[model samples]
Target: MADNRKRRPINRPKFHHTTFATTKLHEMVEFYEKVAGLEPVHYGDEAAWLTNDDANHRIALLALPGLKLPQDKGHTAGLHHTAFEYESFDQWIDNYLRLKADGIVPFLNLDHGMTMSMYYQDPEGNGVEIQVDTFGNWHASKEWMWYSAEFAKDPIGAHFDPDKIAEARERGLSFEEIHRRCREGEYKPEVIPEVYLPEFW
Candidate 1:
């Protein structure tokens, strides 16, 4: 007997928002507001909901009493990172410089073929990534991730020196030029070691 049942694909679900429980709720709110440019749409006594978009909240921070910052361990099971996408390279660079001016450093910068990303840690040590797509559209970026030979060689992405990138920008290098160099692997910035745990899945 042939049995057939319609099953939902594993990748069908869309990502919603991510919530974090932190004792430093106020500090967390400030970090997101200042660094990520998010606004607190809903501010309550125990929780704060923030959004950069029209959605009710893109990120939520709950007041947790006596919550100790989690230690970074290779085996720790928790939230890996939350990523925010930017509309343009200029916007991404502007935010990066703004954070840099505030003395907030990104722990990692990478050319991911499909996107350029800068990873930072919040005051509570939660990972956050700010990125802009390499391609003009989502469909093209998705296809690039799957079919790009560069990505096939290194799916985890290649490290780049954020300082060098900043220097290039300061020298009046165009975004298009920088982006092309990154894609073609000609922008040889000093590669830094990745700090995050490797993905097993």
Candidate 2:
């Protein structure tokens, strides 16, 4: 008998960049720069292009007037928001302080057993994610399904400690360093301990 399970596709399109409308383009630029470290590599009077150290261009900031912001409950139309990855826990901490200084309170903070994240809404009410992946974060068993759920859910009211974050900084690691280590195959990921396991050893 032949196997009934569906086979994975040979290739899927990789994510490139996404554009979001904003009435506050200039303010948004400053937000992304100070918090996310996304540098604007290209721009026009009304539109700006931004890239992180990883991608050439990962986000586009578009100017829109007379636009309705998303409701307090959820996003109203178009792209909800884009999330960007950080290299280490320390990066998130520094960014967190900067966010507080700007009077932006995070909508959510969570530990999904894979990543630690801080969620915020942009000035225009778009979702913005700042996350650092735990080692061996991916669920090898159900890659696509698990991956989708990880980003889709809101992580509001989650608890995290600042001391752990300080430890990462003490080690002198940055997001750039993490990415570099990953690219060079120097970073070895460790499996996260299961939150729930059978009692019997």
Candidate 3:
């Protein structure tokens, strides 16, 4: 019998931005402007659209007058986070330093085999990620993530000290070398503990 299975299209669809409903419309807008470097492109009484580039808008904020969304409790279902990518390591580091100077600190920093990421939360407790790929091109990064032995060994990724990365940059290390050290360095791989696991048969 000939095998028959549906395969994904060779040209996959690209991703657009994410939208959030919030009570603190103004505050959220300000937070994105200061922290994410987004600019408001459209504004309405109950909605606003922001973007960092020439695209129509990368983030949409819709006002929810008196409603409050539940936080990420064990059983709650909602967005985990939305990530934005940087074009270069210099841009990523510069953004990190700028945010740090503004008193915004990331809750987590991880070095996935294919990328370096920093995660933060907005005032409304919405998660946001800023990242730069170890490989400059998306196609290359995706290929590495799919087939890299290091990623296969530790699928969850490893914790990286953001300060150490900054120090390395300050010492004039090349981006390629910095990324190499991160992938092979002392950082421990993150693993999910049994405590957080759900019971299954």
Candidate 3: residue 190 Cα off by (Å): 14
**Candidate 1 Cα outliers beyond 4 Å, as residue runs:** 1-5, 9-14, 66-69, 73-75, 170-172, 183-191, 197-201
lDDT of 3 by residue, 1-201 (tens): 976775877789877688998877898899899877899999888999999987899999999687756543323465667888898999999989888998987777778878898877776777688999888888998898888887888865767767788888999999988887877765433542221112121
Model 1 per-residue lDDT at 129 = 90
Q: Write the per-residue lDDT of candidate 1 for residues 19-77, one digit (tens) a residue.
A: 98977788899999987878999888789999987788889999977766555432488
142, model 1: CA deviation in Å? Answer: 0.3
Candidate topping lDDT: 1
lDDT of 2 by residue, 1-201 (tens): 989886875787787988888878988888788767779998778989898777777778888667775453251345545687776666666777767777865655545434666667666566687877655344542363356563356322234433344444568876445434433334322332222211221
lDDT of 3 at 149: 89
User: Local distance difference test, per candidate?
Assistant: 0.79, 0.61, 0.78
Q: Sort the predicted structures by TM-score, highest score first.
A: 1, 3, 2
TM-score of 1: 0.84
Candidates 1 and 3 compared by TM-score, better number:
1
